[model samples]
Target chain A: DVKVTQSSRYLVKRTGEKVFLECVQDMDHENMFWYRQDPGLGLRLIYFSYDVKMKEKGDIPEGYSVSREKKERFSLILESASTNQTSMYLCASSTPGETQYFGPGTRLLVL
Target chain B: AQRVTQPEKLLSVFKGAPVELKCNYSYSGSPELFWYVQYSRQRLQLLLRHISRESIKGFTADLNKGETSFHLKKPFAQEEDSAMYYCALSGLGGATNKLIFGTGTLLAVQP
Candidate 1:
């Protein structure tokens, strides 16, 4: 089975503090994605990486960034955590033309 | 720009009732669509893909190009079927495989 693991299930951060959310996929998929899931807005893409050292901006990439130094690992970074950034963060990995496998998700609260 | 839209925020149905979750899309090219389900306390996972043409857990989705919609349907809803459903579209080319997702619908199957 494809397994995607997130670094944390819940996190609390102070305003202006930097936050890092990590995701690792054991399936060795080529594409990794970061998405923020809000109640009414659903899941909005933050950033995505098709390969190591390469990244692309998604619909809502303003306050977030992503890094993929290794094929199996992808990290989402918040330059400065804000109250508005508090939401559920989901990570996904998939092969080309295949279904994405998602992590359990991390709920972050910025105070 | 490519976009996916799920009109309903929530849908409630009693057990054994038929259920349908609507999904529409706006894309210029031929699109690949998918339905993903997230059960309570479980990771988001692929419920079905249009290309696969398979039913999962009594749920099936049919992609209608004329209407630009992919609606998930089930003949008999179960209490276990209560979950959040998302519709997604793949990027233009198969190489990137980036997905554009809808706002999502929360289905409540009451027993």
Candidate 2:
């Protein structure tokens, strides 16, 4: 079975701190994504990487950045965490234009 | 721009009653639609896709190009079927096929 794993299931961080959320996919998929899910806002794409060292900004990319050093690993970085950034972060991996396999999700709370 | 919408935030039904979860999409190009379900404390997983044309666990969905909708329906609601359902869309063209998700509907199956 394909597995997309996130580094943390739950995290708490202070405002103004830099935070890192890691995601690793064992399926050898070529695409990885980061999204923040809010109560009524749905899931907003923050960043996506199609290949190693390649990244693209999604609709809501402010205050967030991403790095894909390896095809199996993708990382989401919060340059400066803020209280408003508290939300559930999900990582997903997929082959180009195919069904995505999602991680368990990381619930991050920025205080 | 591609977007998915699930207007109902919550849907409740008796165990033996039929259930329907509405989903709509806005996209100019041909898009692949999908229904994903997340059981309590479980990771979000694919339930059905328009392309498959196969029903899973008694749930079925048909793509309505005229209405731009892909509503999920089940003949009978089961207590185990209670879950968070998300509607997602992916563009078919050369554009990167990142799945855009809906706000989600929480289904409550009353036993």
Candidate 3:
């Protein structure tokens, strides 16, 4: 079975603070993605990296950025945390257009 | 624009009842659809895909291009089947192969 792990399961940050959410997949998938899951909005893609150092903005990339320095790890960075940024963050990894495996999400709370 | 829509926000059913979760998509080209499930305290995982035409955990979804629907169904609902279900669409025109997800439906199977 594939294992996708997130650095944190729960996080709390003050408004205006910079926050980082990390994800690592052991399956060596080529594509990694970051998304925020909100009630009634579902999962909106923030950023996705197809390969190391390559990234693309998704539907809701505003206020969020991502980094992929290695094959197994993808990181999401929030330049400034806002109350509206409080949502469940999910990380997923896939091989090209194949099935995606997801990490146990991180629930972020900005106060 | 590529999009996935899950009409129901919550569906409550009794054990041994039939289950159906509706999902529709809007995409120009051929769409690859999938059903994802997230159980309590568990990572999101793939339940089934339209192309494979296989059922997992007694759930099956058939892609109807005419209606642009891929609704998940099961003959009998088990308590363990309760979870959040998300419909995702891939197979876009570009090589990036990103997925668009629906808002998700929460299934509650009461004993």
Best by lDDT: 1
Q: How high is the lDDT of residue B24 in model 1?
A: 95
Could you arrange the candidates by lDDT from highest to lowest?
Answer: 1, 3, 2
Model 3 has a DockQ score of: 0.71
Interface RMSD against the true structure, candidate 2: 1.6
DockQ-based ranking: 1, 3, 2
Could you arrange the candidates by TM-score from highest to lowest? 2, 1, 3
Per-model TM-score on C-alpha atoms = 0.97, 0.97, 0.97
Off by over 4 Å in 3: B92-95
lDDT of 1 at A61: 96
- Residue-level lDDT of model 1, residues B59-108, one tens digit each, is 99998999999999999999999999999998545877888889999999
DockQ, candidate no. 2? 0.68
- For every candidate, what share of the true interface contacts is present? 0.74, 0.62, 0.77
Model 3: CAPRI class: medium
Q: Tell me the deviation in Å of residue A44 in model 2.
A: 1.2
Q: What is the TM-score of candidate 2?
A: 0.97
Provide the TM-score, chain A, model 1: 0.99
